[model samples]
Target: MSIPILSILVFLPLAGCLLLLPAWNCRRLARPIALVVALTELTLALWLYASWKGLAVNPFPQGFLLLEDAPWIPAFGIRYTLALDGISLLMIMLTAIVFCVGLAVSWDSIKERTSLFLSMMLVMEAGIMGVFLALDLALFYLFWEMMLIPMFFLIGIWGHGRRLYSTLKFFLFTMSGSLLMLLAIIALHLLYAQQTGVSSFQLQELLKVQLPLETQLWLYAAFFLAFAIKFPLFPLHTWLPDAHTDAPTAGSVILAGLLLKTGSYALIRFGYPLFPQAAQMMTPLFYSLALIGIFYASLVAFAQQDMKRLIAYSSIGHMGYVAIGIAAWQPVALSGAIIQMANHGVTTAALFCMVGMLDERAHTREIAAFGGLWGKLPLWSFFFLLFAVTAMGVPGLNNFVGEFLILAGTIKSSPLVAVLAFCGIVFPLIYMVRLVQEVVFQKERQPLSLNDLNPREIGILAILALLDIWMGIHPAPLLEMLHVPVQLLTGGTP
Candidate 1:
């Protein structure tokens, strides 16, 4: 039997967290240990990516490339099942990269309780990894909730300006949605057992049971509510700007980068595939919400005075495109959405890191507080402008590829949606260009002496910059991994 690389990838960080407990008093070792663990996870993810051969003869019917299954609670019909497919693989890669970046950003920013902070980060990484890999409904939810605890602490304890309020709001919004999803998962488990004369929460097994339209609609709504809250679409997105504004930079990075994508990922993995007819019935709702979110978020983002809040709102708008792609329900759109997830992860995380750098040096995130930085911080200004434009979906950049594919696929489904989405792109450029003009080019309001990006900061941003360029210029590799899974989801070749 082959080694269970998936299990190792998921639990290694948890083990690292455990390893940190003994070193709590050894404060100097905390960052180094966390860095090593994060790097290992990234290396493993890359190794997995390199070794992957398509699931040409997947033993599992769900089209997973690597799966590990073992009995965990047979009496309750739960099993320890972790599986990976192309979508999950991409997500894992994103998670690992973002975590490494998160730790790097936190190195100096999180000064108090460093050990505890690093431990929480590692635990969060473990939980996120599990969420991406788990194939059993019960196990998936376990990992789902596991990730939230550390995030709560990360924001509430280490954050600034009404951290408690933001943390509580985030917790309430997420937990409320989680409870609803739990109910849906239970309903499905029970429904499957009633028909099969046995209990199982395996996703592939659950997929075998044909749910009634009424039942599917209810279940899908429960799951959709859960995901949309995390996706934070439109009105459901009120908590996000608050959270981003208050949380520490690393916390914002994780929230924007990996956590948000899980919503869209779950929708694809569980929401639609489990309820085809219900999903079809809900397409109009998705499109309506997505379009509204795109316009609403972009407008609000443009109006924000806080740099972090501006970027936070932009996330909502970017995710709105993802929602539209999913709603289009075409193979190209679905692939684009997946690619968009990775793209947004890299770009937004980099943006947040940039914001953190400015905040670290200036002790403020207010857009008005910064001006004419180009002369003082040339390297920082260059990367900031690159990411800002990349976020705007400029030609020959990462965001453009995903947005273009989404629009292309959406046009085939609904020319009106495609047109509206195309128009929505302008709103972001409005904010982004203004940000560049204000922060990088405008004359200095007062003489300021902020040092430019240091070696560590330069290294971090440089890696992310290369990714943005490489992915934008040549997305064939990403698309290659996405093709089969997208084909399976759409039941057509992309």
Candidate 2:
């Protein structure tokens, strides 16, 4: 009852959305409304972070912050519950940033149904924040489904060419997976009740259920299916490139920056810990899938004509590193995976954003459209160059640290995987450098009066850039935060 700050973080956006309801003579107020809502969200998020810094021990592993719980569906033992941990803390932070930046970035791009647009963005942000913090299976599932709706609408309504096809494909694929997860969640709940006599959806309760190996295997597989689809791992990944390519700039940012992490989060928070034996048993298969995704996606990326599609494919490949890192299960490997998840969100999202600028200015995403843009947009070129370096894990940027940690951690677990994954690093450099050369130095015609990043865009990119450097140089804090969680999950002590 202490103000439930986390609830404020989750639901304020829904409240902010009502401010857009009158929708009449409010056109002038649309941007201001959205900005105020996002800033308010940001303030709360920062407050939680600053508060977290002052706390002596993480209250998350016991359960999340500002805890709240109540019965929602007593017949099914499902309760409405939500909380936060360090893992979800990072996710919440990313969601807040994406929403704020997405809102700001839309100051010029979105025109029709301005209020509706901002409203959807806020709802999506709130929904995703809910997903990260939800501690009840039912609550988590609700938030998970909530995320898909706004994204579907955003794509269907505001996206570029052939948005309908892409949106429908995304919806169908994700919906199917969600249904499977629902069934699995129900099974997990039943198992909990049968074993414990008291039915509850509290994650802490479920985490304690000593499930039989067979049930655990089946449950893990079901949950893994749901997660793999979201991670878009290998054969299950067809929906991603299309989605990223067709989605609007803000859409791509959320898709790459935040949505993908949910899968990995579920894996760490639920899948791996609850079904450690199953994960260890099937590690080989998952690692192989990860390796295939890495090479296959990268190979396909080099062949892409559309820059957005290229970045989309690139996401699959980078996430492949994450999957591989997680599968290794060594402390270093797991830590690397987590670090890489954050790094990828920051750098890849920035890349997609810059590419969005290119698409907006040139009206083309084709790699061949531009040449000699370096002379025209020095500032844009510099930012692009910096992010491109980040993408490839250049030594100075944050990406390098994450990749190095992952590679080193994974190698300690399995040398073969480390060797194979090492081969894929060269490809990032090749594609990123080539894309930069073509976009900046090779293009002949100048961007027709295209200016560089304005103050807002620069602000967003600069924060990311600073983090990219700071994390790379001094990852000590993050490493410390990760050590205990990673050790606990992996059956060891920090």
Candidate 3:
């Protein structure tokens, strides 16, 4: 009876893409159209957040809210199901905000085949929204793979040197993991059918059918491999630097801002809940890998000369914190992990956008190529410093709150992980400070002539900066929204 708000939220961008087809020849119209659509999605997400009843009162049935379920395939028992909770709601909001900012920043930078580029971005957005909303396993997988195509084209077509190689590698790595997940989805569906005489890919329905420990372990591994590759956890993270280094600015923004979050979201939404026993068994392994990634990625980040590549490695390290929190499985840790996902998304996206702005003007991303920018571009320098310190988890910034909670929670669960993670924090500080010194404060290497950020760029960075500060100062609303769901996930009293 009520309007299908979730469906509109998911498909509105694709509809925008369709509307753009008529105006493809009008290069000027493409960005405005895309911006309008992206902002509309953001507005809807804000509305959803505003209207949401707190979890204390509503307590999502099976960890879902704003559900829209309907039978799409009666014969196969596959349904067109969508739902949201605090976690998915936050992810969708992040996707919308990032896409809008990404498009705003791309307006002047992306010139060649602008229409196609904007279209791909919208399609990618639609796919990401679907991933956050879909409650059916089949639907979720569809959205998961849907996002890859546009990104491949974005990187392969619009990217810098080594674009083709990087695109292929990114595609292959992601596709391989997705295929494994697909196989696991089928196995779960069949196993459910065997137990209940009804085949379904709905997550809630499947959750009720228990599997043996061996089966759980096998299935969990399949899903974990898929998520870990996307999360780019440690050794599985080889594809990321290449992808980030060569991707176009918009490509890098979406990849860092939203694509990576999907992996951690999936891990929380499906991995642990579906295979609790295996998740329990694998906690130690996850903690070890997360700790290793935290240290190894931070060290590698410090040694990088390419600014984009440095930020890329920094992403791995930040996500490693998410992994550590998730593995700890305490309510505080899980809440921190969820918040960290958004925190890292904003901070890293800002970093990549700043680097892209520098690269656009200077034609280089080498740290040595930049110096004395603080004198030339004070506004840019201030934002760069703000986001850099935010990334380092400086107190009174977004990353600090999430990192603090994660460390405190990990200390309660595993003091050793907490200590190792604390030590890993030092490397990021060294690298981020070194970056600030070389790029902003040090004397110019070549007396560069760079302009301050334009109104558009400043607007994007300002929104992100304010968000970072706001989250740091007042994280209660976010933490409260997450509290019940996190407690439920951790098997604690909600």
- TM-score of the candidate numbered 1? 0.98
Scored against the true structure, residue 409 in model 3 reaches a CA lDDT of: 94
lDDT of every model, 2 decimals: 0.92, 0.84, 0.91
Sorted by lDDT (best first), the order is 1, 3, 2
Clashing residue pairs, backbone N/CA/C < 3 A, model 3: none
Tens-digit lDDT track for model 1 on 1-494? 28888999888998898889878977778889999999999999998788666443553555678889899999989999998888899999999999999999888888799999998999999999999999899999999999989999999999999999999999999999999999999999999999998899998899988788999999999999999998879779999999999999999999999999989999999899899999999999899999999999999898999999999999999999999999888988988999999999999999999999999999887888889899999999999999999999998899999999999999997999999999999999999999999999998877677999999999999999999999999999889888878888888743
For model 2, name the residue pairs that clash: 64-84, 370-443, 371-442, 371-443, 371-444, 372-442, 372-443
Model 1: residues with Cα > 4 Å off, grouped in runs: 54-60
lDDT of 3 by residue, 62-156 (tens): 56666798998889898999987888888988999999989988889888888899999999999999998898999999999988899999999
Name the runs in model 2 displaced over 4 angstroms: 23-25, 58-66, 443-449
Which residue pairs clash in candidate 1?
Answer: none
Candidate 2 TM-score, C-alpha based: 0.95
Deviation (Å) of 138 in candidate 2: 0.8
TM-score of each: 0.98, 0.95, 0.98
